[model samples]
Structure formats: structure tokens, C-alpha cells
Target: MNAEHGTPASAEPGTLRPGGRTARVRAAVLDAAGDALAEQGFAHLDLADVARRAEVGRTTVYRRWGTVTGLVADLLTDMAESSLPRSETGSLLGDLTANARLVQRTLADPRQGALFRAVIAAATCEPRTAEALHRFYDVRVREWAPCVRQAVDRGEAPAGTDAHEVIRAVSAPLYYRLLTTAEPLDPAAADRAAAATAAATRAGAYVRPSPAP
Candidate 1:
């Protein structure tokens, strides 16, 4: 799902990546699956339904994905691989602001927002989906954690700061609003998230304590 290359990241077990016809089939099936999940949530996701939407054979979907959970897991992997790379703005606030805005815009999009909501709700009860969701956020966190490291190197944040935590902080409030309230995922909210994270990070809020000898 790389935005520029459309190339998927490494396959995990049931996730397939065969070339030519197989790849096209995979893409079509996943796209159809995402559409179905977004439109009707996971409870309504069926292999036959996905097959009809994808125009691929039902056997192919069954053989490749096996179950709804497997398909959803693969979809989450594709989303992680396709997400945009982090911005390098040479400062902690600028970098986090960029990150926050990206999350805001994505959650604010109608289809993407609904898709995310469906996936998140599914994760709450489905163990496989929850693991997939965790991995998805892990990929995204790793992608942006370096910006916090850079901030530390530039003296913008203290040494021993947990870069992953700082990156998570910038997106937490945005996600909270997306799930909890009717408020719009506006740019102003994104900016506030970034600013607050930057301030807290500078105050050593995310710093890890030294390990005991």
C-alpha cells in the first residue's frame, strides 16, 4: 500500500503477494473487502459478498484469505504500508504538527473515517483484528518516532525521551475526539495536539527513567 509505489509490505502468513494475476486479484479482493467493512461493519462481512463485490471467484477469496478476520488483518497491513512517510520540518513542533494534521485529515475523510471506525469497533472484540490493529499503529509509530529522536538531537527535547510515546501523544487526542465526540477533526485541533505534545515533550513528560543497576 505504499502511496507512491502501491507495493505492499511483506506478507504475513495468510497474506498473499504473488505477482501478475494473483496480485491484481489480491488488490481487487482487498479493495472490495475494505468497501464492505466500511459500509456495513465486520458483522456483515462475508466471503461470498466480498467475492461478488470484487468480481473474483469465491474459491479464490476463500483460498487466499480463509476468513473475515484474515482479510481484515491483511487490509490493516496494506493500510500501514500505504500510509505517507513522516515529514521532516527540522523542528519538533513542526514535525509533530505535520503528523497531527495528517491523522486529522485521514480521520475526517468520510470513507476512511467510517472504515477506521468499523475496524476499531471490530478490534474491541476480535482478538485477531485487535492484533492487526496494534501492528498497524506500530508501523505508523515507527514511521514517525525518528522525528522525536531528531528533536532530541537538536536539543528541542530532552535526552532519554521516549520517541514512540511522544509520537503517540500527538495522535491520541485526535483519535479520542474522533471516537468520543461530535467535534470536527479540524486543523486547529490538530495544531493544538501537536503544540501540547511539543510542550509536554520539552518538559520531559515522555522521558524514560534510567534502568536500575
Candidate 2:
């Protein structure tokens, strides 16, 4: 279920650019899809059910998305496009903390948290969903990776720091906390996560390894 992929393939149908009726239909469908995923999880996410909630025809939904996997993949794409842009605070710690707080807030939201958990649970069983999940993270990681580069340019981090790894580190603990324990996600936890990762990066712990001999 850990299948990997890049951008979703061009083979998917029902994809639409922004604006017009097509865009509106896509938006409505995805919103309903998210609602179903949050309420009943992936296993229960039927395309027909989604169409009914979206007030779209079953044939339209089927023709556009083709399958549940295709619909989910498009949903991930929409999510990436709609997500907030990365913060630029002119400091590594500040940027990292901002990213951490964003992640914490997302996990703390009831509907959003349930949607993510449902996707993750489904990804474990569906290879296509797993690939889509990986792509979603890739988009998110790329979105925030520049902060580490800016830190390197500003001499705030080591020259060879792995920017993506640093960013992931800042969020990993928060996600772990969310998934493992029943603890409430608070601002303090986000700050601690950012501080710990920033300290590690400063110490060269996240430097990319040299290629093996």
C-alpha cells in the first residue's frame, strides 16, 4: 500500500480547469466526496453516494472521475491547489514554527482530521489511493521546502542541509502525536516541534548523506 507516484496521470477523465460550470461541478463533487470520507471513511465512499450528495448526475460523476481512485486523486490535487502558501518570516525558526502551527491546526480540525485519517486508512488497503496519498504529500512538501533553502542562503542553516527533510521533521512529530495518543494538539506542541527540528538542523543532524561507495 506504499505505492509511489508523481503527478496524477493524464489518463484520468473529468478533469477541468478553473472557472465555468465544469469547475463548479468539480468543486461540488469534491466537497461532497470530502464530506463522505469524513463521515463514513473511504471504504464507504461510493461514487453514486457522492453524486447524490453533490446534486450531480451519476453518469456525470462516473464519466468524469471514472473510479473512486480517480475521484480521490483529483480531490488531492484540488486540496494541494487550495492549501495555504508557505510563510516567509525571514528566519528558519520562525518559518518552521509557522509551518508547524499550520499542520497542528489542520490536525486539530474535526472534519479535516477525520478526512485525513480516513484517507490514510484507505491508502493502507488500496494501491492507487496510496499513490495518490504520496503525491499529496509530495505537493505539500514542495510547497514549504523553500524555507530551508532560504535559511541556507541566510547562513542560518548548514550549507548542505536537506531542506525537505528539515521541513518534514518539523511536521512528523506533530502527526505522530495526532495519530498515536489522544492528546490535544496545542500551540506549545507545535512550537516544541519546530524548535526541536531547528536545533537538529543547526547541529547538522539532517545533512544529506553522501552517496554510498
Candidate 3:
């Protein structure tokens, strides 16, 4: 898309504008970066190369992102913000199933899967990249934490279950499949994850709430 298409007009310094010409430019650059990272890997992700692919000037890319790590960090933040909110299905199994399905769907998508693989590979060699990846997971995990908490309130899971950890457990295997095995991230995988997580919660894997003291 052209810079004028979705670029934001008033982004703070060193950040992509929220919406307008700058936003469009940022999206294009991010798309180009995803392509380059997937095709060539992080070692080959040159700002100039991304600029050329995005049809933007080198100065604009540099002025906004400053460094490769910075760009990746911003991309992660944007993705987290843009991702769908957690589902409130009112049951531990249902919520976890929803969460698992979302994870499977995202990792199975062509562009998103490739983008994650690129970032994962980059993380192995760069501390900053690894940190950014962790931050991305943190955002996603936090987003779904309440579902676990709600399950506890409903007595579906033991009170005091660490909501964050429960949520993480649901996606851990899915990510493992994405990063390691060539197995398809199908609904079966999602069902397995949901089942495992629900079973664990029922078993009191989550901490129980403290009794009145």
C-alpha cells in the first residue's frame, strides 16, 4: 500500500503514526520486512532492502526505526495491539479451546507463520530479538489471562491457578509444533492442547486461593 493509503499523520517522534500516511508506510515496511526476513533471514534484512521493497526512502525507514531490533520491537507491539481480544466462552474447556484454535490458526497462516519463524531464528542469534519475542508472548499471554481467572471464579479450575501460566500452557505445544515439527497445526492439535490444559486445571495445577486468615 502507498504511504498515503494508511499512513498516520501524527505519530510521535521515532514511532509510526497511529493512522494516516505514516501508518501506511509503516505497514508496507513491516510487510516488506516480513518478506525479507522469511526469504533471506535476519542476516539479510537490510534497511535499504526493506525500503526498496516498500517503495519508501531509506531515510524514512532509518529515521523511524533506527535499528533492526527497534523495527522488530515495534512490529511485535503493533501485532499485539492489532490481534483479536480473548474469547469469553464461560467454560474452561471452551475458553481454552478458543485460545488453542486462535493460536493454531495464526501459526498456520502463511505470512504469519513465516514471520514467526524468521523472528524465532533471529532470536537465537540476537539477545534483543529474543527479548522482543518474549515481550510479544507476554502481551498475548496477558491478553488471555482473564479467561483462566474467570474459570477459577466459576469453579471450573482450582482457585489460585496462575492464570498466565495456564494460558501459556495452551499454546506451548502449538508453538513447539510450529518451530520444530513439520506436523500440521490442525484442529486436532488445538483440541489436544485444550484437553490437556483443561485436565490440568481440573487437577488443581493452578494455585488455590488462600483461605480467610
Root-mean-square deviation of every model:
5.0, 5.5, 4.3
lDDT of each: 0.91, 0.87, 0.84
Candidate 2 residue lDDT tens string, 52-157: 9999999878877889988998888788789999999999999999999999998899988889889888899999889888888898999999999999999889
Q: C-alpha displacement of 170 in model 3, angstroms?
A: 0.4
Candidate 3, residue 29: lDDT: 88
**TM-scores for every predicted model:** 0.92, 0.92, 0.87
Per-residue alpha-carbon lDDT of candidate 1 for residues 1-213, written as tens digits (9 for 90 to 100): 533224453434346556787778888988998899889998999999999999988887776677899999999999999999999999999999999999999999988888999999999999999999999999999999999999999999999999999999999999999999999999999999999999999999999999999
The model with the greater lDDT, 2 or 3, is 2
Would you give me the overall lDDT of model 1?
0.91
Which portions of model 2 miss their true places by more than 4 Å?
A: 1-10, 14-18
Shift of residue 4 alpha carbon in model 2, Å: 32
Query: Highest lDDT, which number?
Result: 1
Candidate 2 to truth, TM: 0.92
Q: What residue pairs are clashing in model 2?
A: none
Q: Quote the lDDT for 158 in model 1.
A: 95
